[model samples]
Target chain A: MREFALIDRLSQRLANRRADTRLGIGDDGALVAPSAGQELAITTDTLIAGRHFPVDTSAFDIGYKALAVNLSDLAAMGADPAWVTIALAAPELNAGWCDALLDGALAAIGDASVDIVGGDTTRGELSLTITAIGCLPAGAALRRSGARVGDLIAVTGTLGDAAYGLQCWPTRDNATRDQQFFIDRLARPQWRPGAALRGLVNAAIDISDGLAADLEHVLSASEVGARLDIDTLPTSESMMRSCDRETRLGLQWSGGDDYELCVTLNEAQLDRARAAIDCPLTVIGEIEAEIGLRAFDRHGVRWNSDKARGWDHFA
Target chain B: MREFALIDRLSQRLANRRADTRLGIGDDGALVAPSAGQELAITTDTLIAGRHFPVDTSAFDIGYKALAVNLSDLAAMGADPAWVTIALAAPELNAGWCDALLDGALAAIGDASVDIVGGDTTRGELSLTITAIGCLPAGAALRRSGARVGDLIAVTGTLGDAAYGLQCWPTRDNATRDQQFFIDRLARPQWRPGAALRGLVNAAIDISDGLAADLEHVLSASEVGARLDIDTLPTSESMMRSCDRETRLGLQWSGGDDYELCVTLNEAQLDRARAAIDCPLTVIGEIEAEIGLRAFDRHGVRWNSDKARGWDHFA
Candidate 1:
């Protein structure tokens, strides 16, 4: 009964009235009507205490990041976010804690028009599994397999701020403004909309496991390769001020938790895509006929891709 | 790298080459094409170790029940199973254990025509969260708000056997065939198809948190009451032989996890509904003008609902 009472209270805090959601919450399942000519894009992600984030991380940030990460996946597919189901498990039902967590989630979903449709609340070790549903025009899905040889590879926003933020977190109170920027980036990753880039990008993926590893997924799927210009990789002003060139370069390439979009497009579409997107877009690589990734510095010196590795949870 | 490798292996084991699933497994989000004139039904559930099931429960049964329970939700909504996204978290990635778990999930999904779409794998305390998507003809969903006065309330299959199974699980090897029957019900709750009952039933819900509790949800939603005939609830012969009368009645009313459909319909549709459904259907109650549930024996003696309380994760 306490679980039911808690869910009822939390459901009210998250509820939104939307035309597409015929039924929401308080049901066995939610009924959703998709647009006439759109296909549904579905994704699920899980965040666990002490694994995905610091053990002592605030519930507010955890809730915010959970939704942000799933929305990032939808953005990668060039789909418009519509609905989400949250399955939350916690050791106890603390009203104040749950309220703050949900408040942060609502903040992350601000004006995106996504509805919290259905969910299950259970008692267990702290974790959240969120399944986000979105819609895309029937043939407009930006699949990972569509990257072709000669396509220009681009990324939105700067990378490695989140990783740097993790390192400076313990002593965050004494940090400079530059360091605080990194910490904020770690806590609340902005959900960059990619739905407008459908016709401008050949393939797209979100940088959850770092650019080096995530780009490898697109390369493997498309059976192509890429050569990145190390000097062209984007870095934040804060990163430039706080770290040396080597550290910044490694973080830019291999540091994870940057929820930015990495896309491949033709040269002709570059200008139009930049104007269409909401964030800073930078080209750092081009697709190749060869089947693996390689990198080069400004002086044309080759850097082994193996030297900058991405995250592997089990590793 | 090992997490991705394990996911790749398990993905192959659970993959289905489906036409509706335009994109699956290896993407940020999956693209699914729902049939024209159908609304999507979405539901999510989480199963955690030591909380949802015994710590030593087989990975196979854990996988099977996780999917089964979600399917039960879809069934309650009168929807056809379509796709599922499984977010799995575990302490370690054991090859044999994962293979067996996937195999069990496959068995539960046997010939249902549902596809495994997209998911995330994380390291944490063992748990599985499954989000199930189903389809129903537009406006055909059997919601919980349509029951009315004089409507017949019916239940499918048997109840209470699962709760009995839980009690006998620790010494399952020494149990009789009848006791094993109850144990099997707990381990594997069959997925009953309810999509065919859309027009036949006015309202429906799955009996997960015991009929006594779940029925109250329907009464509360529809703004009506019910009079249940305790003598009429369907019970398995195994349940009858293993327990005394009062114990049998308690299990039937309050023991949870039966995964059976509880529905209401006009008396005129009873004969046709019984003929159409695949399983046994028995009328155990009728809607009343009052606003709460009451019970009666074969002799018409009244019984208070509070005596047979339903399971509450946090009471």
Candidate 2:
């Protein structure tokens, strides 16, 4: 299929939704009206080859992961996904690969209730940038600066699975069966935070960078410090079985690409939050008066180092 | 300066604009509330190095041209310029170059009363994509499908200056002082027909891929045919002096990137349109009953062609 034909076919598949989208695809740009009493939240993320993802990754995974990560941003803001515009750059027109990629992207968007409203296709080295727009009730959206001292720091789902999966990808023979599950989670992580927590979480952020680095972002934004307890960090059963305790804990603490939500709430609201979420909420820390992050091991020893850094685009 | 700092500087400079921008810069996305009874019109254009522009072109001109092309799209739809989003991909970050580029971009946006609301920056091969959003009254949007047979085919401003500029860029020795002026027009074409023709044009499109090709797009969309007079095509005085009559006319008829509005209007609206525009109006043709485009000379000699070919991405 040519670029125009491929876009037409994809547009047809997307038009069947008939949801909140005022205009579907086939135009210079798409038009959308926001739901009443809601503010639109928009974000753009670009995934580049050999930088954001490995070069050998499947086209399907690339497509799936591109939209998934942007959806994760919306989830962190406690917003309902609405529409997305993808600007794709690739070297040549590969019909089969394009179809597969679009399939993966549409499948992910379908699950999130987001429509592929508009996009641009061009020829260049492989790079995909997705701009997602979500809607949230007026004055009810979450922000990174809403956390207060003495708030309970909680994280949904598991961390480090994606990062560990990446580490094991280059040497499959060195990976155990349990590690394979970690790899899958890394490649196709789900980012649904459930609709119930819309009004509950105060400050929230998704763990695209490692837990330590992402937590630092919240700390810096909220102007509060945090002390994470190593014992309370959530690690998947597969992670625990495949790796030693220290390695698992270290990965849980510092590995990145985990699209899990790390949210902060007042101690008074913890009971309500605990009852709201279906996923495990690990209370690994507490916000402090000081403005930095620290980690305490099970032995009560603080792990003070400059080594537990996450992914840096410039670096 | 770093990317964030550069953005901060640029945002500060744009803070003085009085455009209908609800939110300006330094946010996840800029917010603009369309006026009551108005619909948002949008279009995106991507320019890649060695593809859309010469490699050694000045950064400032590149920036001016990038935003100008998108503004031309808004002009074609008979919309008032409102907001623009720029996505820039480059191999390296140079602060001086970035400042110069932003200067040129802001100059154009400022001129059109469009706000530089939000944008994305990434490191890659040099390419710039701009998504411009405008506003037209609920039922007054001029679309390509609204043209009717017997309507007069008109063009705003002259054509072929930009294409002529490209040819002269490689051979400075062949370019006269007057030719350089035409070259600059090609390098940084202005978008006309701002708020003046919001309700006058029956159907319109910007002449990016030359008049023959872009008019065909309008024809194909409206399912109509046109008979263009080759003798009536508009050209700059410099263009006429520098090139032969055939080449100058051919460039006016078929050259791309003029960024001028090509519109169809009834003969009844002709006098009002001529009075409304700041630039002169040239009637080049009339819509035909058949379903294809043809060109005729002043002597009524028909040029044989099955299709009006423009710039094709894949071709």
Candidate 3:
């Protein structure tokens, strides 16, 4: 089949001979042996061509972001991303384009220590569904329901840059260097949480649906609220240069596609947790006994959380 | 929010406290623990509305068949299925219809020892992608490339029943016993190979793309050929009552959606393999030194393997 042929092209460049992967790709399924005393983590996401990404977007960027988002889920759960399966359904396209797409995906996967183990390809609507599997020690996976009162809430890296990217994408020009950074951020987000920091976070979630909305998931699950310090929120220099204060701040608060990890942890673990990631880690909030998320400015005034637009109306 | 509400409704009824599944549906990802010294088997499939099933097919049938096809892949590999992840993308549909789909999928999943681990739900074109993870002892996972010359080729249960169902679906009636039986087979294909049959077959594959084409995959993978006895194919009473012998024979040979296991094994293993499967297991062919699949009539004359319609012309 042409689909299998394309997969073979991707497989030729793969060097995934991990000790745990007794079998990877090319069979009815892939065979893996999880480490003793460790738990396995799995996540799946579907990206539609018109709804999730621009139709004209390069296959390489699409491929990179698809895996990146799934990796973000693993990072949020404090798991080491190990394997992925992609089920791509598309209208008829040039084989060359498919090859480029797979090359881009494999390029991203190669560095993350993730293997393309299994997949299904068919002709239909253009959609990509990916399942990422990861591993962590038993009882050590960072969940969203473990945040307690007074826990320091922190985020790994700047936010809203990707949202800013999406906002300015149509007007992006080669001359707007700062805006280009936002677009690039949207296209290729890095997962800042590494294996070394798995057990340090009390609660965690990936910012796929904006910090305000995703944090609400943590609050609702943990039965606690958070007070975020708006001034202390991390913002990229590019985002500041590209937009006005209100637009920038609004994007920072309610914008989606950040792919950063928002976590709650003990204050004592802050130094060690920050050291584990190369990105700037900012302490944005603290959990409270109250049951709804709120944000406060440096002047000690509450900012309206309801004003920030929620990305996923579905959730 | 409605999607999460629907998921919660499904989750409340789930009693999955598997020691392997530390975390389930609600988290960013699920946490599972595979036993030490066992290999994990992973398979993924994607089914699109209109392409995989008739647009008017019931949500219940669609949901059941989606999981059934993936389970068939696991059965082919002789893997003990353990976990499943579904990424569902659909256009706007009624809440009641969505509930019916989930109920159907859950009903099928409830009987198997598999847990619904993680998934993504979103608004998009209608498609369902499922990834199933299974476990087997290290080096024990079945493969399609292990068949050798002189091995006996066998099949489980009946063939062409689902294909027959599709052919007769337009005329199906609730009161027509044979038609209802065929339709049910199409919707709820049972994976006949249980755990007891694992490691008993040399090489296997689910008969998805018709025996003429799927057999080529095994032959090409194993670097062997097959000579199938056309008379030996297992056909159901429903098929006999519904069609002429020639039509039944043609459907049995070239039709898809059987979900039956077609395998090759040493002649000595026949008794044990048949004993392991409660469904009828019949020797249908033999692996040979020649490099092509040839099906023979009971009179010992070769039937036309090439004239059989290729279900997947992509190959």
For candidate 1, the docking band is medium
User: Candidate 2 — which residues are off by over 4 angstroms?
Assistant: A1-3, A16-20, A171-177, A193-196, A271-278, A301-305, B1-38, B171-175, B193-195, B275-277, B299-301, B304-307
Give candidate 3's error at residue B91 in angstroms: 0.7
* Per-residue lDDT over B1-315 for candidate 2, one digit per residue giving the tens place of the 0 to 100 score: 456556666777677364344455544344444444565565667788877888887899889899888888777777777777777778877778888888888766655667777776777788887777676666676778778999999998888888888888876557678767876887788888645776777888888887887887789879999988888888788877788977787677778888888889999999999899999889999998899888988777776553345665655
* Tens-digit lDDT track of model 2 for A1-315: 356666777777676353545555654455555545565555667788776778887788888888888888777777777778777888876778887788878766755567777777777778887777676766666777778888889998887788789877876556668777876777677776634576777788888878887787788768889988978888888887777887887788888888888989987787788788778877889999887788898898786546457665534
Name the lDDT value of residue A122 in candidate 2.
75
Write the residue-wise lDDT of candidate 3 on A252-290 in tens digits.
Answer: 788888898999989999998988877877999999999
Worst 10 residues of 1 chain A by lDDT: A303-312
The lDDT of model 2 is: 0.76
Worst 10 residues of 1 chain B by lDDT: B303-312
- Put down candidate 1 lDDT per residue, A77-177, tens digits, no spaces: 99999999999988887888888788878888888989989888888888989999999999899989989999999999998899898987886779789
lDDT by residue (B1-315, candidate 3, tens digit) is 367676676677566746677778888998888898888889999988877777778888888888888888887888888899988887764577877887778766656788887788888877899999988888887788989999999888898888888866886654388888777777777765545567787898888888877788889889998888898899898888888988988888988888888888898899989888878888898999999888988887787867565464245
Can you give the DockQ of every candidate in the order shown? 0.77, 0.34, 0.69
- Candidate 3, superposed: residue stretches over 4 Å from native: A172-175, A299-301, A313-315, B173-175, B299-301, B313-315
Model 1: residues with Cα > 4 Å off, grouped in runs: A299-301, B298-302
Taking all chains together, each candidate's TM-score versus the true structure is 0.98, 0.89, 0.96
Error of 2 at A190 (Å): 2.2
